[model samples]
Target: MEESTADLIRAQLRRLRSAAGLNQEEFGKLVHYSASMVSAVETGTRPYDRPLLARADEVLASGGLLVSLLRIAEREGQPSWFLPWLDAERLARQLRVFQPTLIPALLQTEGYARAVIRCDDLLSDEEVERRVAARLDRQAILAQPDPPQLIAVVDEAVLHRRDERFRALMVHQVEHLIACAERPNVSIHVIPLSVGLHIGLSGPFSLARGADGGWVAIMENQLTASPTDGEADLATLSARWETVRNEALSRQQSVELLKEVVKSWP
Candidate 1:
């Protein structure tokens, strides 16, 4: 939520409390928040988080209005350009990904996803939560009755990068990767650091195969994804996919590599 949205919620809280003939201290008692914390939220010094908002909604007799507002605010926080790609991902019969920078979105744990999102120091906490929710929501496709076949070719560097803040989640993510690889429909590969140069070094890309057997390539730059369905472009990306496939470690080898990382993390 933006500061403006926070202000709106605070205003509503204040009005509802006033109407109920309760002072800040009385309202705080009802909502189980400190008087100072209530004041901070109302005066825009603090944002209204979900749990607080839920309690406030119940105390103020708002009939879930605040909770509904939270949902609306979260949806509004999503980046505009990313929605289309999400639609494609949900519909794809098969997904082929070449990721070099970080774990693929489908395999990330909530903690790992938030740690990655927080790297953008500019984003507010509410914004960070929204992005995390969006990313986790995207992971649901993997659990569908006939989920997409996930083939991820990731570089070894992704496993080597470690910091105390994210190391635990990285361990969790690596274990999760190994688990996903065990599924018959999923295939994961690691491009060994020894393979100094590879086609994936250029950047990350994904190929989504549709039910009709048509393939589309999605590539991202700094800002947003550009999905190409043109025959020539798809053909070129297909060849790149084959080249990376040959350079990456086999599925069994990738599982072994992930197990190694799991053992190495402190």
Candidate 2:
């Protein structure tokens, strides 16, 4: 198999770091990242973004070689609108998500992700596969040594998806959710159907608090998604998040609910 542009970049980074006589720990300090993050990038477990690449280029005196490679890799996948949100997500210290109609992208199983992407119908099979791969790649953040706190509030209806054709897939997805919820950095809460209608019905959105303490948010619609750091937007979404979270079942209750819902999938 041919190596992807991303793979090539990772290999080059690893080679360059070694030539600089810097171990992952020593190099990461210069780049302002954790050693584990440097290892993740070199090992192809995490996607390299522009900032990280640029910093590495300067730190290693690569004369912009790393950043140049990243430009090529960025063109290979991911939509333009999603790029900002993706960067924010990677740098976030805390992520708060509200999903009314489906599982949050970060927590979706591969099968569920493919199904959701395929719903577009307009996309070719190649595009669908590319998107699924990108979505799965985004999940690597959860495994980082210093992962962001991910608090997700989902509508109970998302788990009770009634498509018979997807029954088994949904079961596996819910089981994946149960496993994710067990992680200390992850919290999954479900808003019961008993709540009837609520503010979360507006749409799905996410807020990410970066390491610098600044917050940014992404609002998703059927056609596209956009990210914002404006005060007004943040304020409104923050209020909605608080309201939806309040309506959600406790974490323990949500996990129990997930277990029960899995049994109902058949």
Candidate 3:
């Protein structure tokens, strides 16, 4: 959670404790918290420390429910707003990412990501660096010994043209894609321009296999992101994705396409 949101949760905890008619010292004792620690949480000086949050959940008769919800916010390096989604994604067994306009973030090389970041009109160099760090941190998941299976579908256009420096970076990205595709856990698909209109016209979305083997669909538009965990909605998105997959070029064809584009680079 963002520091501010964490503060707010702490405030709520204080209120909840008060509502149960427990003084700071008494509540701290019940939750294994020091009186000063409780005071710190109440005043927003500290976030919901894990142990305290768990014990407090029980003391407040919440049956440990809030503990699970709050732990998602505790994951380090997650953006305050994106924490919940990150929590959901982190638990996924497989990831299906479709990028209609650009390269998939997880598969991007640092050079490619930096090149993409340079196109942002709003970010200062420092801000871009911060975002880059966060993105790279996310990419670290791909390096795990038993990382989730990743199926990335991208438009062939991303392989062909871009600014000159980005062209070099794109070459590296293509090479990386080829390497990753060779791995048992990764699959790369290319949607050709010849395929024409399809469900992807609605734009990019990520399909994740949840902890319970359910599907979670996540879409980010111009300014907002939405995640639909409903099975019905996910089923519809899965159908759409299947169409796009069928329309896309085969893996061998995509590799050949990348080779052709790399040969044409200036």
Q: What RMSD does each model have against the real structure?
A: 15.5, 6.9, 9.4
**For model 1, what is the C-alpha lDDT against the true structure?**
0.80
Candidate 1: regions farther than 4 A off: 1-78
What lDDT does model 3 reach? 0.73
Worst 10 residues of 3 by lDDT: 76-85
The candidates, ranked best first by TM-score, are 2, 3, 1
| Cα shift from native, residue 69, model 2 (Å) | 8.8
How would you encode candidate 1's per-residue C-alpha lDDT over 1-266 as one tens digit per residue? 34355457778888888888889899899888778767866765433456677888888898887777666665776443443345456667899999988899898888889988999999999889988997887787888788889999999999887778777778888999999999888999999999998778889999887664656677888777776666998898899999999999999989998899899886
lDDT of each: 0.80, 0.86, 0.73
Per-model TM against the reference = 0.70, 0.75, 0.71
Worst 10 residues of 1 by lDDT: 78-87
Candidate 3 error regions (>4 Å): 1-81
